[model samples]
Target: MRSLLLLILVAAIIGGIFFAIPYFRAHPLGQSTNPGATPTINTTATALPATGIGTIKAPDGESIGISDGTVAFATGGPGGSAKMQAADKLKAGDTVSAQSLWHSALTSDSGDAESLIYLEDQHVLNAHVTSNTPYVTIVVATMMTGDNASVGNDNLQGAYVAQKEFNNSSQLAGGTLVRLLVANSGNDKLYADTVAQQIVLLAKADPTFVGVMGWPFSSRAEVAINTLAKAHIPMVSQTASDDALTGASPYFFRVAPANKRQAVLGAKYAEQSLHAKTAVAFVDPSDPYSQSLERYFAQQFTADGNKILATEQYTVGQKGHAALPQLLQNAESKKPDIIYFSGYAADIGVLLSNLPTSGQFATLPILGGDALYELNYPSSARAGFKHLHFTAFAYPDEWDVQNLQSQKPKF
Candidate 1:
């Protein structure tokens, strides 16, 4: 009897520590905790190569100041090169004067090649002798919806910034530079196919476009790969962490990790780390991402000798809290140790808000996939669900991490 009492006391203490800590009170989605507040400035401007004489016009017809030893040409969209052409077929060590090569790009339909910077203006550069030109174009394509899809935009922006810096540097290829072409699918549901078709068309117009950057959603990637495969174009994605995409096509690749890996990691934490044995699940029956996670969690939990006490599903945008009362009553009778929610943030927030006052979930752990990582879940509502836990992939923004670690909160 005395030993039983001590075990009970210890359990209470452990539970108390889990809830009472201030860190526990802080929501992961809350304002960034970055330490450094100010951004450092890079004030150095790109220095153009010194040229004896002649003017430099960018692909867009914008004249950049000329310098000795520097070569210039057009950049950006297809429209930028209209009417204007390279003055000559200059090569790597060629010393051809600017006037010699001016308007030299359009000698034939096949000869409308990408421009390059020359060393001597003497011979056509060997590097530009691509069975096609030595240039590659990348396109970022994504669906207009889902957190998973939006993640690609972040990576795309970062890549563009890096590309700009690279092009301006002295380390550019053969004294030439790189260029980028950016397009938005405009949140079009058909954008997956439309944007992909556009990319292929762009490549047809200029075979030098050797690579692509993205398709934010898995479905979009699936659709785009059909064309990308035949074209031999390799792609990298920031989102679409779907396993079905990898190795599915020789040309398909993604830099961002997939959701399957995330779900497995989250499930391990929910089952082993949180010690949840009996769980009740609320899934969104219509969404593939939610359904996939639910199925995996169910299989994993059952494998661990734990049973799902109950499962209740609603459509993607169905009224969630309205069904919660009856579900909670049923779940209480089964005494689940956890409630695993598999839905997007907007819907899950409603379900979480409506959990009944009486039952195991009133105080038990509430676990979820990436759905709970949203910033919109009310802090107070989350406070009510003290035992909530979820998985998040990347560390928050760099500056945010620094501020939070320093405890100098950014408003």
Candidate 2:
């Protein structure tokens, strides 16, 4: 019985993909802070046969598919002669310089390479494969929308790093091909279902499809998890923090500790550190992650004898402060010591920015859940803000994780 040793690091950041979104600093500037790291958890599992044979195409031509033989990003084509030379060098065994050249080509303002996206860096995953070697397969299913798929693009870049790391690790991987596939599960239920279904089919046909990596948020993960559950293939996530995913499925595993754990931590802090007796929750009904975290935090806090002041719900598009007056009024009545928010960083930022405007309400410490972890700080903070607290699973500095994909035979 080969048990798969799966490991995940607890942090707001995942691997090379780091985002600085919104969240108030609940802890002091230095409270044994961790920039975050994902541990390389171990699982003793039998190696299943895997190879690249079947196609996992997306619907409506809205996917990022790049075979080894193919070059460049899906959104852009491969570059010029110099780029090809750099590509050749990278293939020939020089990564640092070749990657540097590739970076230069991407950075160039001159007509340079038209098939290159300035923000994307997944070419390493698309490196050519000329061998007939058996390989291990991993898929990264992330988003490709929302402002040029900003978050998704970063995750894609991170996957490329994984591919590179796997390819280069000497002791870790003796000599085996690590094939990587990418799918765009654009923040939706049905759409994610379609992409996930394809992954299942791919796993069925291609025995090498060992596991999957993304489906970033809880909503997307909900569909993907169900689809992959049928195949019994595992998925390791860095940032999706829905309490439902906590040991819910054998096929679903997370590197970061779930939101329930985070909520409990917050509750402990409220009871001892802040000495809070009352609390309220701000939830986004549209987001699975937000709702789950909010519920878990409130439950823990209430269990600790904290009064449930009020729980207010809202949608994603609704700005943070749109209902501030009423929320303030409720807070005033309950007079909670800490205000809790559970949602995306963007929405949370709005509330954090506007909290100071509500007189006495501003003085009360505002506490938030893990949705507070992400990059978008410049936009999240208001001009005149005092203090806000947010929780996170991990920090990037805590882990030295890498991604690498190869096409070599196993030793």
RMSD of each: 20.8, 13.8
lDDT per residue, candidate 1, 155-271, as tens digits? 333443344333445233444433444444432223344445445445545433445556644555776676555544555665456566768875576655666777777678877
TM-score of each: 0.52, 0.64
In terms of TM-score, which candidate is strongest?
2
TM-score of 2: 0.64
Q: What overall lDDT goes with each candidate model? A: 0.48, 0.54
**Alpha carbon lDDT at 76, candidate 2:** 39
Candidate 2, residues 4-99, lDDT tens digits: the string is 011123111222121110111222111112224211111112221132222233343443322231233333333444455565565566656566
Give me the runs in candidate 2 sitting further than 4 Å from their true place.
1-105, 108-134, 147-150, 204-207, 317-334, 378-386, 396-411
After superposition, the stretches of candidate 1 with alpha carbons farther than 4 Å from their true spots are 1-136, 144-157, 164-182, 186-190, 206-208, 284-287, 317-335, 352-364, 370-388, 396-411
Error of 1 at 197 (Å): 1.6
lDDT, model 2, position 43: 18
Per-residue error for 21 in candidate 2, Å, reads 35
Q: State the TM-score for model 1.
A: 0.52
